[model samples]
Target chain A: MTTSSYVYYPGCALQHRSHAYEVSNQAVAKALGIELVELDDWNCCGATEYFSVKRLPAYALVARNLALAAQAGTEELVVPCSACFLNLHKTDSHMRQHPRLEQAVNEALEAGDLHYKPGSVRVRHLVEVIINDIGFERLGQLVRRPLYGLKLAAYYGCLIVRPDNVLDDVEQPMLLDRMIEALGAEAAPFSMKTACCGGHMTQISETTALEMIHRLVTNASVSEADAMVTICPMCQLNLDVYQDAANRMFETSYTMPVLFFTQVIGLALGLSLEALGFGQEFVSVEPLIEKIRDVPPARSKPERRPKQALPMPAMPQ
Target chain B: MNATRPPTFFDRVVAATPDGERLSQCLQCGTCGGSCPSAADMDYTPRELFAMTMAGLEEEVLASNTPWFCVSCYACTVRCPQEIPITDLMYTFKQMAIEAKRFEHRSTADWSESFVGFVEQRGRSFELGLATRYHLFHHPAQVFKMGALGLNMLRHNRLALRPKSIRGIEQLRAILDRAKVLAEKEAWR
Candidate 1:
């Protein structure tokens, strides 16, 4: 945890479908002086679908990555994709909890001449690394081009902070919001922040997925956020790629721009658009970029509470 | 003379789940169902499904579309008062339904198989291959509908046309094969 360097595990989706996230993450990391060493010869972590079909094999698949990371001798393994992060984290945690499963997985690993001790290497999400390792004070000082007038809705699709609230609150995560604010952008009140974007249901059950996507876009639209920022590639893909399909299915004219948190951070860091991989988004961010003001707008006045209204319960510490 | 009932479906599920002893502690609360984003799409709510499982309604439970609709967001799993690992149980039900050939939805299973097929062959997932193979086999009409999106991805250089194999794919294959054997042995046990 002391080292600013980590073994980077860019899951398959980030390598193929979400290059914007990869480049921006790297650019941001470099600017922050954090060293990211890519894990060599890594394979798929089976995502969510693999575990459903075969449980033991899925653990072994993710364990292979852990083994490789351990072999690389890095204390921390930074994974960008939410699904990959969850799979790797869950595998390690479960291996520690269930000795039988660990024994079974290690038996499989014997074939590859690799073995991993549970908890040998820590699995972390990239956002957590950037936020925790390099605090907001450092990020605020480093911001060259503040995203002043932009209103961003932080979308933390399920996997990153669930099944074990590894990073933030399960129902209401604010790390993304805090990051948005740290970048000098307004964090919109998006209630459906933790809502599911239907994962691969777009392929399996199109009707249901479209409806789910429609709801998410509709929430951001109602909130009047300029764009929705996300950490998971699947969330971005669902909201960005299938936006048109959702629009057609719902007959709504919502044009919310979905972006990766890294891309937004890169913008605030004053990096060139090309360096941040901006042009690759299905929804063009050019118009959103135009809305960036040189300085943040004046803070809006807080609404006065009603005399009869009861005090809201304090959030758990 | 003595009479005894067979092991319930609940018993089978609990036995299969790694930490499934907690399943018996389910409060019958609808939190899982209420928290589920796709609960409306499920034939039976998670609470109802749990009751049905304990009642030994194996065929009906397997045939239900409840498990297929789960997106694995894990909202229900975290919120479950009983901490029943509700999401993992969904995976179990999906596997069981697929093995029994009792699942109502074919396209979901097909998509999963196609995804795993790519992973197995190349040690990585090929989104382009998964999309083409799945849409072509299941919804040929939707291919034309999704053509522009596919072209858009290619235009942005986001979609890789070719699948890349890892150098240690042979090692990966050996590990996966051994894992498969272990899974089968566990199932038989």
Candidate 2:
């Protein structure tokens, strides 16, 4: 379940916004005996918009990270943030397919006195690496305090399992499901699991993003999930930062705490809340932690399927 | 400016895109439109936008918020039966809008500009810097509104008040510049 080496790229979000994901990721990795070396001189992956506005600059920006990871002399680079993972992985795939893009990206890199080859370094998300390299069997072995009473909705957001995927099915991935099960927490039915979290749309148009977040938060709550576990910072940010805004917009109050997948892993390993970087969210985890601590471990109560259940409600216009 | 010029919107988009010809293959089915979370907000659903582009309604398409309304979620791109990279196609429309200077989605456009500028200048994003720039150009009043949220992030160490830049920033700037020049010469425009 342990590997000798893999490089890590925390991306822009982890440096600040999702610092907890970074901390908990490293803690979980260290406990699992895999040391993740940070990539040197990495730059932002252009996040969501740059690539759309200016094609060449975005590719060049992402390529810089790839070139550095390759320079670090590792075949596999593990990314904790899904946006970073997608940027790195998608760039490598594009470079391999389109000679023009490859030439342009590489030419841009030459200015930095750096160059990258297509497919030289493999990019894997931390969750995928955990589920694959460090098998769930060993991951389960590390759990000191099993999350017996917690229920989680594995939120994949838009980037992680998307246009280019290898770890799991694009629409209905089970990697996180298995992980939650291993830690003894129930993987609640996440019907809207693969839906978009509005990404940076919340920054530009809160009205539209609020609608999207409201759907996701409401769905998770209806499923009786305790927390929504996510693999991307953008998803966590939108869900947490805009929870109250969403509730206000929809005239519905829903409290659902979003946690990075690694945070859940850290909790299962019995690491301190401080070590996992908990209590740093807009929608506080304080109540959820208390509930988990005060309650005895209980089996997940599955929602009973109703016979001839009323038809699904139509989407609001 | 060039009323006498040839009708070239489709040809230009095709030449610029990796699979521009695929745009012609759209089944007129509303899968992209249906799957889009922001479709209700868009002036034209991606389906309608694609149709407009094919119809050579360049001015309307360029000025419309259809492209900017896209959050780049890729639900359409993933679910498209024709395997169209609809999101990237939307991105193409966004770039065209920016280049044409006919875009009306001021707030989104400002954010995109600020985001790209932040990446270019610091070799990484300064979250506060990006937000401040966006607010200045788009909605200065919202800056005060965001104070409480900003304080929460600041308290949690989610944002650093002073940006810590990455090493080799000059090289990053050079790469972006050179790539711009090279892309300009790609024979698409």
Candidate 2 regions off by >4 Å? A1-3, A293-317, B1-7, B187-189
lDDT for A221 (candidate 2): 94
In TM-score terms, candidate 1 sits at 0.95
lDDT (tens digit, per residue) of candidate 1 on A21-76: 99988888888888788899999998888877778888898999999999988878
DockQ per candidate, 2 decimals: 0.71, 0.67
Q: DockQ: which candidate is best?
A: 1
What 10-residue stretch in candidate 2 chain B is worst by lDDT?
Answer: B180-189
Candidate 2 residue pairs that clash? none
Query: Tens digit of lDDT per residue, candidate 2, span A210-294?
Result: 9999999999999889999999888999999889989988899888999999999888889999989886787878777765643
Evaluate model 1: give its lDDT: 0.89
Error of 2 at B48 (Å): 0.7
